[model samples]
Target: MSKMIFVNLPVTDLGASTRFYEALGATRNPHFSNENAACMMLTDTIGVMILTHDYYRNFTQRPIADAKATSQMLLAVTVGERAEVDRVLEAASAKGGRADPNPAQDHGSMFSRSVEDPDGHVWEIFWMDPAAVPGDSSTVDA
Candidate 1:
């Protein structure tokens, strides 16, 4: 079987979070969804599980960091072209997300931008010209 990834996030408003993800082109999967959690499918292999704060707490003992005020992990997604990255940021912004929370990155071959969801979870959208990568590629790590 192929590997799949499901990034679980704690959300204050399940409805708003679900809608925000829809704006980014994800569809809710009813099979894994309920009143306290919504499973949004970004792709066949990538999914996002947005759970209510109460429900999320059931899985973790640590305090939930206020994503708006504190730094946590950053999530990223790659698109096929540079224009797609811009389109995603615009969509996210239109759906109450903060566009470009971080500085944009343009390395000729790789272009990236960031957006923060209403809960302050940062999502980086990027595109890269695969051919521009060196044969060794390890030298380009950043």
Candidate 2:
């Protein structure tokens, strides 16, 4: 079986968060969804679990930090080409998200940009060329 990555984020409204993610091209996963939480699939191997504040507290003993004021974590999605980065960022913005207040890195090898969700969770969309990647001689082209 293949391994999967599940990212759990705290949200005030599970349905609203689900709608936001759905607008960004993610689909809901019924296998792990409920009234208090929604599982959103980013890819076959990556998924995000949007949990309501009340439900999220049940998973962790630590305090849930206010994402708007201070980010608890940042999620990054990588694409195969630079154009994809812009496409994703644009889609995110169209869905009520905002562009991250940072410059994009165009190092001729790798490119990256970020966006902030309504809840202030940062999502960085990037593209890296394996052939042009630095310090990675172990990688080979087909």
Candidate 3:
């Protein structure tokens, strides 16, 4: 079986976060959604679970940082083409999210754009060309 990636993030409100992610082209997985949390399926292999602060705190004893003022993690998702990056960012902004105020990277072979969810979770939508990617390294410096 292929490995699936799941991202767990803390949100102040579940419904608001769901709407924010939905606007970014993610569909909610009813199987994992509830009042305390919602599973946002970004793709077949990539999924994000946005949980309320109270619910997420149950998983750990450490304090969870308020993402709006402090960044906990940055979520990066790839696309097949650079256009998809803009498409996703636009959709997100339309739903109250904000686009990162910086130009996308153009490493000759790859391109990317970024957005911040309502809760301040950062997601980078990018496109990569296999031919341009380094053979020995999984990622480029750019």
The lDDT of each candidate is: 0.92, 0.82, 0.83
lDDT of 2 at 50: 88
Q: For this target, which candidate reaches the highest TM-score against the unseen true structure?
A: 1
Backbone clashes counted, model 2: 0
lDDT of 2 by residue, 15-34 (tens): 76787787666799898899
Clashing pairs in 2: none
Under the 3 Å rule for N, CA and C atoms, how many clashes does model 1 have? 0
- Candidate 2 ranges beyond 4 A from true positions: 134-142
Per-model C-alpha RMSD: 2.5, 3.5, 2.8
TM-score of 1: 0.91
| lDDT of each residue in 25-101, candidate 3, tens digit only | 78999998999999999998889999999999999999987666776666788777767878888988888788974
Against the true structure, what is each candidate's TM-score? 0.91, 0.84, 0.85
The 10-residue segment of model 3 with minimum total lDDT is 133-142
State the TM-score for model 3.
0.85
Clashes of each: 0, 0, 0
TM-score, candidate number 2: 0.84
User: Order of all candidates by TM-score, from best down to worst?
Assistant: 1, 3, 2
